[model samples]
Target: MAILSPRRRRSTALTVAAVAGATAAGVCLAVGSASAGTISGPLYRDPSSAVVRWVAANPGDSRAAVIRDKIASQPQARWFANFNISTAQSEAAAYVGAANAAQQIPVLSVYQITNRDCGGASAGGAPDLNQYQTWVSNFSRGLGNQTVIIILETDSLALLTCLNSNEINARNQAISTATRTIKSANPNAKVYLDAGHSTWNSANETANRLRAAGVQYADGFFSNVSNYNSTSSEANFGRAVISALNGMGLSGKRQVIDTSRNGGASGDWCGDDNTDRRIGMYPTTNTGDSNIDAYLWVKPPGEADGCRYTAGSFQPDLAYSLANGVPNPPTTAPPTTAPPTTAPPTTAPPTTAPPTTAPPTTAPPTTAPPTTPPPTGNGCSASVAVNQWNGGFTASVTVTAGSAAINGWTVTITLPSGAAVTGVWNAQASGTSGTVRYTNVGYNGRVGAGQSTNFGFQGTGTGPSTASCAAS
Candidate 1:
């Protein structure tokens, strides 16, 4: 018999909450609304950050164009240019101006200066330190305080395992110099250093890098950028790193995280494409952590980074699958309790010896009929529903069980055909099985039976054709 993986058998329950209260309270409740609990800090709003790339990649694809228009139509959604300085300067200038003209903030990812594109698969930067600094200086010149959130060089510090000590040091220096240059140019600009996700770097190690990179000079460190992990885990991990930084003498600092892609955490180190996850609704509000400034959408949904576990390179079907939780195979039942046994009834011998011959021929006494087995009770069941409204999607689900309470579970959805998931919440998605599978990352292992929790996702898609639910 095929048994579902333990992680796959647990059921998922979803719940959705509305935005209410003051700005601060709204922020707190919005972030806390998910199953992993609330995250701290203000929510970053950026919609155009990924649309440009989608348009550029699929110049002729009508679906991409439609999604792009949908994204652009939203006043809250704005674009940011992420490219090597040499390639992005002109485009960045145009976008920056457009964003300012529209009275919106443009979130930019400054690449090219560091040794980016060096490692491959979202790797490689400047070949040398001086060159990296030069590029950042030029990149900073283009920003004229138009309100931009810069996600400086992702994985540059954490990828040290793939580099030598000297190389790592050089990269750190470049990042520090770049941060200083950007701040000097635009004091009003919100610049956040990329501190890879929690699973990748421990607090001590991440703090050490932050210190080396001069995190004090900038706002703070960014975590879970361009990765698929829930905000809860990221928040916990982010808090630990912030605490470590404070212990290292940098206290009361603020930071931000990229909630763009992590609707779910990666099931493995590599090659787990579960696309049902999407860009969580924009402006996710504040986490309670004083150090965490905001959760921003940096990675556009549906765009693939070359790893193809799904179709269309990005796999809309997989994205839908992940968005709607897919059922995993079943598992062995828990041990059952045994009932007590009764004592045997006493038997008596026949009294009459003279009738012994007749007694031997006597008929046996009648016996009571056997008891019937009890009806099997319903096992835990959960259902997640998703709907497309305006330029994004909303998700909700219900959980039921006979013997357990739904404490924690993951609900993932895959994007339908012609739809691309740009963001999600309380879950994560990556390339998997020719589709994207969204799974609850931090809360996946915690949901108990019969308990229900709800989450929401905001992204550009054809909306949801069908939404399903499963445990695990």
Candidate 2:
């Protein structure tokens, strides 16, 4: 947390689960996204995240619904900010193990560098550089031999203005050692050093510091973690850094941006609560940019910046404001007829891309994008298409008119006991709890013969469910 008196920063791995390649865009998980969105790969969703836990414990909380849909349902990086070596090792193991079980890639951050945050509000780390290396080594052992992304310290390079040359050299040495420790233990682990944000330092300066800090041995560097800079701006900044790195003979390096809270205007405020912030794009590797590796939610929304609340603690109001009116691209409404759907309308990148066409007539053997049996009931047929990552899932229900036309449709979905709808769109829900009932909204209710319409929802506590539907 730099005291530039403006928005300043920001931590937190899993194995390469087959599911790690899938994104988690909730309502934006419309049809035809399989090849859609600038996003590439998917990241793991930690079920035990602050927002998920809060939503589950306070299922009836006033803000649970919005928070769950907007915040909890997406994949978030897990931080190992504590200095305790033993606890951190086991914690890392458990998280990566769970992600491997779910077949998704996990993102992690290691923030235990000595004298972190310039002794600002979020200051504190390992007692010294040697102990920090030991901590990172133990932590890396837990990464398994699967694909995982590790975001190193947030301000290690960007905030070097306060450190003397000797101190900076020592910190850079520690970073180099940590990178070697992580890569040696598990080559599958992708380690990203910190480059801060676009405004903090010039590209050349950031590149020089990154070189000193050992970016060559890591995956690349990350920008805007725990900051409020726009994604586009961060991407451009990343390009500058990459160009600079290339000039330094560091080719083939790519970067990931933290889109956790940069949906609104960029700012320089740090360590204080700001209500105008909004969650940015969902995490994805399909950034559509060659230089940019992915767009990630490195900083989980709602966690305080150490001013309004303790840093890393959940702040419900802040979470709500960040999630409120999220900027996800609009999804297509149900069609008038039920023929196989074309790609739904897409504005830009998707958090979790969904299949545009109808679910395969026959189920595929693969497990990542969990699809349901071909379904038809009463006067209408329904299909449940679900794409889940780690703890949360997004599903689309395509309802088709039968042999005859209908004026309206009602669909019933049986959620598992602990499952609930965190958010929904393209239809109105009867209740978020228990067996939820869904009905048509003001438009798209009418269906010509063989016509079709659709709706989608985001959920927690469980994955996809069987749905029964009918037409009026």
Query: Who wins the TM-score comparison?
Result: 2
Candidate achieving the largest lDDT: 2
Residue 318 CA displacement from its true place in model 1, Å: 5.8
- Candidate 2 lDDT tens digits, 135-212: 888888888998888888766776554467899899999999899899998988888897867655678888998999
lDDT of model number 2: 0.64
Query: Local distance difference test, per candidate?
Result: 0.43, 0.64
**Estimated TM-score per prediction?**
0.53, 0.64
Candidate 1 lDDT tens digits, 1-472: 0000000000010011112210110111122231121232222323233333344455565454344433222222222223354744455566566656755556665545443422322333566677667667776777787456676765556544334578777777778888889889888677778676654446787788888887888777766544555566566667788889889899766656665444443222111233334443233323334555555655444433332332113443333333333221112211122111232111110010000000000001011111222112333344443333333333333333334543344444566665654434335555422255555544433433433333333334444433344444
